[model samples]
Target: MDQRPAISASQAGDGVTLAASGNWTVTEAERLNGEIRQAARLPSGTRRVTIDLSGIDRFDTAGAWLIHRTARNMVNDGLEVVYTGIGPSREILIGEVEKSDRPPAEPRREAPFVTALVNDTGEAVIQSGRDLVQLSSLLGSTVLIMAGFLFRPWRMRLTSITYHLEYMGLRAVPIIALISFLIGGIVEQQGAYQLRYFGAEILSIDLAGILVLRELGVLLTSIMIAGRSGSAITAELGSMKMREEIDALRTLALDPVEVLIVPRLIALVIALPLLTFVANMSALAGAGLTAWIYIDVTPQTFLPYLQNAVALNTFLVGLIKAPFMALVIGMIACLEGMQVKGSAESLGRQTTAAVVKAIFMVIVLDGLFAMFFAAIDY
Candidate 1:
C-alpha cells in the first residue's frame, strides 16, 4: 500500500479546521505538499485555522518543518493559526525549526558613484596609515635584533644565512644578469639609433654608461630580488607559521626574529649590493657589446666615453640604494609571512602579498633616495 500523507479540512462559520493523517515522512512529502496547498485554499471569508496532527502515523524533522512553515505562513496571511496534537518530542523539533528559520538577507544597495569613490578613498588613506605603522614596527625590531647580533655574533645563524644566500643570491644571478644585459642592450641600441639622426652615434656609449650606473642596473636588480627572493621568504615563513613551527620556536625560548628573520635579512643586506655590482658590470658589458656590433663603436672608444660620461657619484648612488632597498624587501616579506593564518590559502595569500608589497616598497625607496640625493646634490 502506498503510504501517502492526507489532509482533510472542514469550514464552519469563519474558521477552518485541518486534519493531517498517514505518514508525513519525506517519502510522502509530495503528497503532503499537495494536500497542504489544497487545505490552504480555504473560503475567502475564513479568519482562523486549526491544524490537528493526531492521525499522523509517522513524522520527521522535515515533516515538522513543513508543518511549522504552513502555520507561520497562515499567520503571515492575517489568519489566526492554532496547532494541536503535537507530542513533546515533535513539538520540540518544530520549535527548533521555528527558532532556526530566518529570512534571507536583503541584498545591499550600492551607493552613488561619487559617494562610493570618496568612501573608498578615505578607507585607502586609513589603510595606508596602518600599513606604515606596521612597517615601521618591523623596521625597529629588525634594527634592534641586528644591533644585538653585533654583540653576540655566535647567536647569528650562519648556516641559515648561507642557505638563504644560496637560495636567494646564487640561484638568482643568472636571471638578473640576463635581464639586465638585455635591458642594457636595448637602451644602447635605442640611444645609438636616436643619436644617428644627429650624427652623434658615439654618444650612445655615454648614455648607456651613465644610465646603467646611476639607475637601471641596481633598480632592476632590486625589483627582481623583491619578486623572487621576497616571495620565497614569505612562503617559507608562512608555511612554518601555518604548521605552528614559529610558535614552537617561541615556546622553546628561541626568538624567531633573531633565529630566522635576522639571517635572511643579513643575507639580503649583504647580497643585494654584490648583486647590484654584478648587474652593473653585466649591463655595461652588454651595452659595450651592443655598441660594437650594432653601432660600430669599439671597446676602446666606448671605455673612454663611459669614463668621461659617468662620475664616481653615479656608481655610488646606485650602490648606496641597494642595501636600503634590500632591507625594505626583506622586512616586508618577513612581516607578511608572520601575518599568515592557519591555512594553505592564507599562506599563499601572504606569499603573494609579500612579493607585491616588497616590490612596491623597493620602488618607493628608490624614488625617495633619488629625491634625497637630488636635494643634497650628491
Candidate 2:
C-alpha cells in the first residue's frame, strides 16, 4: 500500500478507465495535480471515461476539488464521464465542490441609445423637483427661526454674524477690487476702440458706467462670493458633519441650522450689497482712468457723461439683486453641506457642487431680474 498519489489510465474498445490511488490530500497536492493532468489525456478512440476512486488511501477537499475540476473540463469537451467506488465521505466532499463550481456568466447587453437618453432626462427632472422641495422646506424653517428671534432678540447670534461678515467681506475686498478694476479697464478700452471709428470715443465712459451699475458690478461680485465664500461654507459644515459635531449639537438640544446657518446667511445678506457697492466704485474708477489715458476724456468730462448715461434706478437695480443672490448662495451651500456623508470624498464633492449650483442659480436669478425690469421699463 504505497501512500503516495498516483493515477493510471487503461483503454479497451472505445472506453477508458482512470484509477486514482494512495493519499489524495493536500500533502500530496503537487503530485496529485500532475497526475490529474496526465489522466485528462486519454486514448484517441476513447468515447467514455470512468474515474475509479476505490484505491484512494485518504481524501480531502483540495484533492476532491482538483478531481471534480478535471471531470468538469472533460465533460465540457463533450466526453461522457462517470465516477465509481467513491465512499460516502469522499462523495460528499466532491458533491460540495461540484455544487460550488459554477460556469462563467454571460455578458450584459446595453440599452438602446434613445432609451438611455430618455431615462437620464427623466431622472434629472425628478431630482430637480426634489431639490426644489427640500430648499423650500429649509427656507421655511429658517424663516420660522428668524421670526422667533423677533420675540427674543438676544437669541440671535450677532457675534457669529459679525465674524462671518469680516471673514467673507473684509478679507475678500482686495481680490474683488483687483478683478473688477481689470474688467472695467478692458471694457473701457474695447468700448473706446469701437466708438473711436465714429469719433465718439468719449462715449466709452458712458458705456462703462451704465454697464457696471446695471449688470456687471453685482453679477461679478455674486459669482466671486459663490466660488469663494459659498465653497468655504459647504466645506465647514461638511467637516462638522463628518466629525459628528452636528450630531452632538442635536444631542445638546440645539438646532444646528439656527446655530450654524442663520448667522452665515445673515452675514452674506449684509455683506453682498456692500461688496457690490465697492465693486461698482472700483469699476467706475478703473473705467475713468482708462478713458482718460485712451481717449483723453478727463474725469471732468467723464462724470457728466456718466451722470447722463445712468440713473438712480440703474444703480438700485444692481444693488437690489445682491441680497437675493446672497440668499441663494447661502441656501444652496448649506443644503449641499447638510447632505454630506461621513467621508472626506463626500465633503469635497458636495463643496464643488455647492459652488457650481450657486453660480448657476445666481446667473439665472439675474436673468429673471433683467426680464422683470425690462417688462416694467424700469
Candidate 3:
C-alpha cells in the first residue's frame, strides 16, 4: 500500500470519474494539491463528475478541503458533481469545508455627492448637540462643587489652585507680553502708514491705544492660553485617564472633578484678568515705542492723544472679557480630557481638539461680548 497521495481520472458514458488513493493527510499535501488540480480538469463534453474517496487510507481537513474544492470547481463549470465512498466521518469534514467556502457579498455603492454632503452635515450637527449637552452637564457639576466650597472654605484646594496659577499665569506672562508687544507695534506701524497719507500720523497712538485696551490685549492672551495652558490641561487630564488614576479617585470616594478640575478652573479665572492687564500694558509700550520710531511722534505728544482717544471704559472692556474667556478655555480643555479613551493616540487627539475648540469658543465669546457692550452702550 503506497502511502503517497495519488488521483486518476477516467471517462465512462459522457461522464468522468476521479479515484483518489493513498494517504490524503497534510504529509502528502504538495502531491495531493497537484493530484486534486489535475482531477478537476475534466474531459470536454463530460456532463457529470464523480469523486471516489474510499481508496484513501488516511484523511484530514486538508484532504477534505482539496476534494471539496475540486468538486465545487466542477459544479461551477456546469457539471453535476457527486461524491462516492465518502464515509460519515469524511463526509462531515468535506461538508464543513463546503459550509465555510461561501462567496463574498457584493460591495455597497457610494452615495451621490449631495447625499453624502447632507449625511455628513447631519452627523456634524448631531455630534455638536451631544457635545453641548456634555459641556452643560460638566459646567453644572463644577458650579455646584464651587458653591459647596463657598460655605466650606476649608474644603477648597488652595495649594493646587496656587500651583496652577504659578504655571498658567506667572509663567505665561513673558511670552504673552512679547507677542502682544509685536502685535501692537505692527498695528501702530500700519496705522501710521495709513494715517500719514491723511496727514494724521500722530493719531496712530490713539488707534493703537484704543484697539489694544478694548480688543487686541485680551484676544491675544486668550488665544495664547488656549494653545498653551489649555492643551497642557487636556494632556494632563488625558494622561491621568489613561493611567486609570481618575478611576482610582472615584473608587476612593473622591469626586475627580472637585479634586482635579476645580483648582484649575479657579486658577484660570483669577489669572486671566491679570494676564490681560499685563498684555495691555505691554502692547501699549510697544505701540508707543513704534509710534516714536516710525512716525517721530514722541511720548510727550503721544500720551495726550492716547488719553483723549481711549477712556477707562476701553481698558475695562478687555479685562471684563478675560475671566469669561478663561472659563471657556478651562471648560473645553477639561471636557476633552475627560472624554479621552485608553490610548496614547486618544490623548493626542483630545489635546488637539481641546486647543482648537477653546480658541474657536474664545473668539465667538469675544464677538458676543462686543455685541452686548455695543447694545448697552458700554
Candidate 4:
C-alpha cells in the first residue's frame, strides 16, 4: 500500500516531538506541506521541538525541506529544535536542504540623498578618466604602428587602403554633395532674406562663401564621415573581434592594428580632404544657383563677391582641419571597435558609441581650432 504522507505532533514535559513518515518525494510534496504546516502549530508551553524521521520510507529534497522548515518554525517560536532517528540517506538530504535554507535578510538602509549624489558623481568622473586613458593608449599605439610602417613602407596595405578609400570616399561623394548642395541653398536663402533688411542682399555671396569654406563644408563632411564610415569601421572590427578573427590574427603573429586599423586611418586622412574639397565646391555651386534665382544675382557677380570675400587662407583653414578630423574619427572608431565584447549587443553598442563620440570630438576639435585660428589671425 502507498503510505500517505503524515506528520504527528505530541506535547512533552517542556517540548514537542514531531514525527514524520511515508512517501515524501515530489509526488507527495503537496500533502507533506499541509501536514508540516499543521504540525507547526505547537501546543502551549512547548519550549523545545524534536523531529523524528525514522518512520519515513521515501525521502527526497522536497520531503527533507518540509521537515527542516517545521523545525525552523518551532525554533523561531522560541523553542530549541533537534532532529532524532534521521536515517543516513535522509540526513544527507536534510543536510543539503539545511545548507540552502537561510534566515531572511535584513532590509537595506537607504543612503542619504547627498551621499548617493556624491557616489554617482565620483563614478562618472572615474569612468571619464578611464575612457581618456584608453583613448590615449589607442592613439599612442597607432602612432607607434605608423612609425613601424614608415621603416617598412612595403608592409603598408595599399590594397586595403584603396578599398576603404573607394568605400568611404568615392561611394560617399554623391550623398555628401547632395546634402551640401541643399544646405548651401538654404543658407543663401536665409542670408539673402536677412541681409536684405540692411540693403546688403549681395553680401549673401560672402556669407555663403565664407561659411561654407571656413566651417560648414568641412564640419558637415566630418560629421557625415563619422556617422557613416566611423560606424561601419566600428561595426566591422567589432564583429571580427566577437568572432575570434582578431585572436586568430594574433595567433598568426600578425598585428591587428597594422593589418586592420592603419590602412583605414591612412585612407581617411587622404579621402577626407578630397571629400571636403568636393563638398565645398558643391555647396558654393548651390549657393550660387540660389543667389541667381532668389535675388537675381548673376553668377558672374556672385563669383566675384565670393572671390573677394574669401582669401586663400579661408579655404586653407578648412582643408587643414579635414585630415585632423579624419584622424579623430578613424581612431575613435577603431578604439571603440577594439573595446567590443563577445556579443552582438556589445557590437551594436560600441558602433553607436563610436559614431556619437566621433561626432562630438569632431565638433569639439572644430571649436578649439576656431579659437586657435582666431588667436593666430588665420
Candidate 5:
C-alpha cells in the first residue's frame, strides 16, 4: 500500500483546496507538511483550507506541529487552517497541542530610524560598561571552578565535557576546515585572476595570509562555535533549567554559576582559540594550494612566502582575540540559559538568543581588533 501523504490542489468554493493524508513521523512529516503549504498557496478562489488526515492511521507530535506551522503561516497571511477530516488518533494529538494554555508573546514595538540608532548606541555603551565590570567576576568565578575541579576531579563531569567536545569540536572540524579551505582558495583564486593582469600574483599570498589571520580565521571559528558549542551549551543549561536541576543545585547549596557555568565557559574559552588556530592553519594551507594551482607557486616557495608574510605578532594578535570571543560566546549562552523561565519554549528562545548574541559579539570584537591592530601597527 502506498502510504505517503496525499497532496492535491484545486479551486474550491471561495479559497483553496489543500489536502494531505498520512501519519507524519519526524522524518517524513516535514515533506508532507511542505505539500500542504504548496496546496494552500495555490492561486484559487478558495478562501479556506480543508486538510484531510483521514488516511493517517496514527500520528504524533510531529504531525500536530506540521499542522500548526502550516496553519500559523496561513493565518499570518490572513487565511484560515483546519482539518477537514482528522482521524481519531491524530485529532487527539492536535487537540492537546492546539488547545494547550500557550499565552501569546508580548507584542513587539517598532522605532523610527533615528530613535533606533540612538537607542542602539546607548545600549551598546551600557553593555560595554557592563562587560568590563563583569570581567573581574568571570575571572574569579573561573578560578574558583578550576580549584573545585582540581580538588575533586570526580565532581567535574569529565565524561560529559569530553562527549560534548567530541561532538562540538572534533565532529565540527571537517566542516570548518572545508569552508576555511574553500574560502582561502577562492580568495587567492580571485586575487590571482585580477592580479595576473597587473603582475601582482605574488601579493595574493600576503593578502590571503593577513586576511585569514586577522578576519576569517577568528570570525568563522567563533561563528561556528556559536552555532555548535554555543547552542549546545545553551541547550545543556536550558535542559537543566527546565528540569529544575539549576534550582536543585541551589537547594544543595551549590552555586550554579560556579559549578555549571564556569566549567563550560572556561572549557570554551580554552578550546575555541585552539580550534581557531587549527582553522588558520587549514586556511593558509588551502591558500598555498590555490597559489600553486592558479599561479604556479609550489609548496616549497609558497611556504617561505607564507612564513615571511606571517610573523609571531600577526598570529599572536589574532590568538589574543580568541579568549575574548570565547568568553562572549560562553557567557552569553550561560547567561541566557540561566535566565530562561519555567517552560520548554523559553529554553528554546534563550538558546536561539544565545547563538545570535554570540555571533554578534564575535563580529563586534573583530571590528574592535581591526582598529586596535591598525592603530598600533601590529
Candidate 6:
C-alpha cells in the first residue's frame, strides 16, 4: 500500500494538500484517486481542493489522462480541483476529433510548358478568327441598321456616333500625343546607330518619318485606343449585361445589338484614321526634334527628306489598317462584354481580355502590312 492524502474535514473550512510537484504516472493512478476521493468526503459547506503537481519531474499521456479523470470526478463530488503549477504534460485524449475536423487540401501543380504553349496558341488563333467574323457580321448589321435611320433619321445611331467620337477621340488626344512623341524619340535613336556607321545620320530623320508614317503612327493609336476606349466600352456593356438592362431593352421590342454595338463600331472605324493622322504628325515632329539634337539636322532639311520617304500608298496604307484595327477593337470589346457571366469580377476579366486581344491584333496587322509593303517592291 502507498500513502494517500487525507482530506481534513471541518465545520468552517476544509482543503486537500498535494505532496510533491512534477511528473506522476498512470502507475500512480490508484494512489491519486484515493487522495481525490478523500478530498470529496469533506463537508459540503467547506469544500475546496488544491492539486500541486510541482515535483517528481517527467510524466507521460498516462498521467495526464488520469489527472483529467480525477478532476472530473472531484468536480462532480462538489470539490474544487485547482490545477496549480500544473502544465498539461500529456493531454492527448481528444485525438481523432481534431484530426477529422481539419480536412487536408490537395497541392496544386502547373501544366507542362510545351503543352501549355500549344494550348494557348491554339486558343488565341481560334478566338481571333471568331472575333474577326463577329466584327464583320456586326459591320454588316450596322450598315443594315441605317435602314431604320431612313425612317427616323435623327435616331439613336446618330446620337451614339457623336457621343462615342467625343468620348474616344477628343478626350484621348493628349495621351496619344505623349506616347507618339516617345515612340518617335526611341525609333530615331534605333535608326541613328545604324545610319551613323556610314556617317549618314541625317537619314535617321527619314527613317523615323517612314516608321511613324507606316507603322507606329497608326499602330500606337490603335493600341492606346484599345486599352483606353475599348476597355471602357467592354466594361460599360458588361455592366449592362450583368444588370439585365440589355435584355430589358429587348423586351421593349428594341434590338440591343443594333442600338448599342453598331454605333460604337461605326464610331471606332471613323475615328481611328483621324486619330492616326494626328499621331503621325506628332511622331514626325518628335523625330525631327531628336534629329536636331543629335545629328544637327534642322526640320527644314529633315522635312524635305521626309516628304519623299514613301509613295501615296504609305499614306493610304495606314488608313486601311486603322479602320480594320478600330473594327477589331470595337467588336472584340462588345463580344467579350456580352459574354460576361455573373459577378463584377467576370466583367473586369472580360474588359482586360478585350483590350489585350485588340492590341495583339493591331500588332499582327502591322506585321502583315510590313510583308505586304515588302512584296509590293517598296
List the candidates ranked by TM-score, beginning with the highest: 1, 4, 3, 2, 6, 5
Candidates by lDDT, descending order:
2, 3, 4, 1, 5, 6
Best by TM-score: 1
lDDT of 2 at 285: 87
Compare candidates 1 and 5 on TM-score and give the better one: 1
For model 4, state the Cα shift of residue 290 in Å.
Answer: 1.5
lDDT of 1: 0.89
Each model's lDDT: 0.89, 0.93, 0.93, 0.91, 0.80, 0.76
Candidate 6, after superposition: displacement of residue 116 in Å? 6.9
Candidate 4: segments with Cα more than 4 A from true spot: 1-31, 42-68, 83-122, 240-245, 342-349
Task: Give model 1's TM-score versus the native structure.
Answer: 0.82
Which residue pairs in model 3 clash with each other? none
TM-score of each: 0.82, 0.76, 0.78, 0.80, 0.62, 0.66
lDDT of 1 by residue, 116-177 (tens): 99999999899779878998888888789888877988877899999888887888899999
Question: Tens digit of lDDT per residue, candidate 5, span 107-195?
Answer: 98898999999999999999768755665576677777778887787877666566655766678788888888888898889888888
Question: Per-residue CA lDDT of candidate 6, range 322-361, in tens?
Answer: 9988877888898888888889899989998999888988
Which of the predicted structures, 3 or 5, would earn the higher lDDT when compared with the native? 3
> Which residue ranges in model 2 land beyond 4 Å of their true spot?
1-107
Model 4, 127-166: lDDT tens digits are 7788889888878888998898878889888899999999
Model 2 C-alpha lDDT per residue in residues 228-279, reported as the tens digit of each score: 9999999999999999999999999999999999999999999999999999
Model 6 vs. true fold: TM: 0.66
With a 3 Å backbone cut-off (N, CA, C), the pairs that clash in candidate 2 are none
